[model samples]
Target: MTPFMFVTDLDHTLVGDDAALTQLNQILTQHRHEYGTKIVYATGRSPVLYKELQIEKNLIAPDALVVSVGTEIYLDGKNTADSSWAEILSTGWHREQVLSITEQFSELELQPDSEQRPFKVSFFLKQEVAASVIPQIELMLEKYKLNVKLIYSSGVDLDIVPRSSDKGQAMQFLRQKWKFAAERTVVCGDSGNDIALFAVGNERGIIVGNARQELLEWHNQYPANHRYLAQNFCAGGILEGLKYFGFIK
Candidate 1:
């Protein structure tokens, strides 16, 4: 039998209303125990924040965590760094340089230090300024020859990480480590940050109903049968995706 793997983003995609969360937890728990399906949480949150979310939102702990927008990986309740990922990020990345450059833009505000990670820097850009300022920011990165990638999501949140680090790359790393076939993997997400996950076309992708317009647009750009757009929001939508992909009956 093919080993199955389920990966989901935590924020608005998986964490929903109390009823939805309860149903989601129940479904996930059943799937794990009955089929041994592996579950992973892919998020921008650090392990610390993730644990807090687990408690505050009553989320189920997963088999593994791809945290800080895929720069770090933790397995079986033990926080472990992906050394290869770290090595790739170590060169050409200067957090202070990125921060100093971004600070020049009056429209950008540095996110709290708690959100910062060794290979990632986060900032908030007002919706109105995002359009005009992002290009300039990218140009600055280019000018500095920084080996960083910029991710803008929900029209306000911005993240900069090593060029090689992303949700999709992290998923790929874990999939290889776990030896799960691409055909048996399912990834669910709802924003721009998740585009990389969907871009891993060999694996299934689910964009829930409440997905941002940017995500919908991105999905439409490259229509594929492997990617499904769910009609339900949050956990309901994830369950719908699982059913659509025949992962669950």
Candidate 2:
């Protein structure tokens, strides 16, 4: 196997199937040891939530963790947060103002305090009403002149982060800082929030079979030869993609 950066979203993208996840963990861990492969997990989960999942699922320890919808980053299991990323996001972010504006909507339910970060404000908006409510929120933010981006996923989670902050942007930061070749990188995901992961780079991409409608729509709208839509679901999908991209045998 060639050395590559393996970046993935958790939840349904990498964790839905226990057996598949275990197999993937073993493969990634061995590659990290032998080939200097870098592994990253970018997810909407907070550090605390991620830790919980780590214990439950026995996930491989990634070289870097992008959490809180890419609002926060931690390196090598360090307790310290990455202040550099925070500084970059601080330029256009106004968390309090975001909360203040979003507070007006009764349809939006604030997520737990842990899930909220200095650069991210999250909520739960039902899928049925998200279409109408998101635009309204967008109008309010535009009127207020706030520079934030809204990301909705899992048919429920709504995360508002700085305009420049997201899983893809974060991954780009890591890739550039580490000098990873675009061709030697792979990103795996299964939802709308993961769309940006596929959009910004020439890195090989894997869209799992059991993807959400939003992601499927995006894949159909902009098909790329660099990306493979796998026939398997979850971690199995990732394994299939690694083969399809020739990252492994």
Top model by TM-score, which number?
2
Q: What is the C-alpha RMSD of each candidate to the true structure, in Å?
A: 1.6, 1.0
After superposition, the stretches of candidate 2 with alpha carbons farther than 4 Å from their true spots are: none
Indicate the residue-level lDDT of 57 in model 1. 91
Candidate 2 lDDT (Cα, whole model)? 0.92
lDDT (CA) per prediction: 0.87, 0.92
The estimated TM-scores of all candidates read 0.94, 0.97
For model 1, give the 10-residue run with minimal summed lDDT. Answer: 80-89
Off by over 4 Å in 1: none
State the lDDT at 104 in candidate 2.
95
lDDT by residue for model 1 (134-218), tens: 9999999999999888999988889999898899998998898888888899999999999999896589988999999999999
TM-score of 1: 0.94
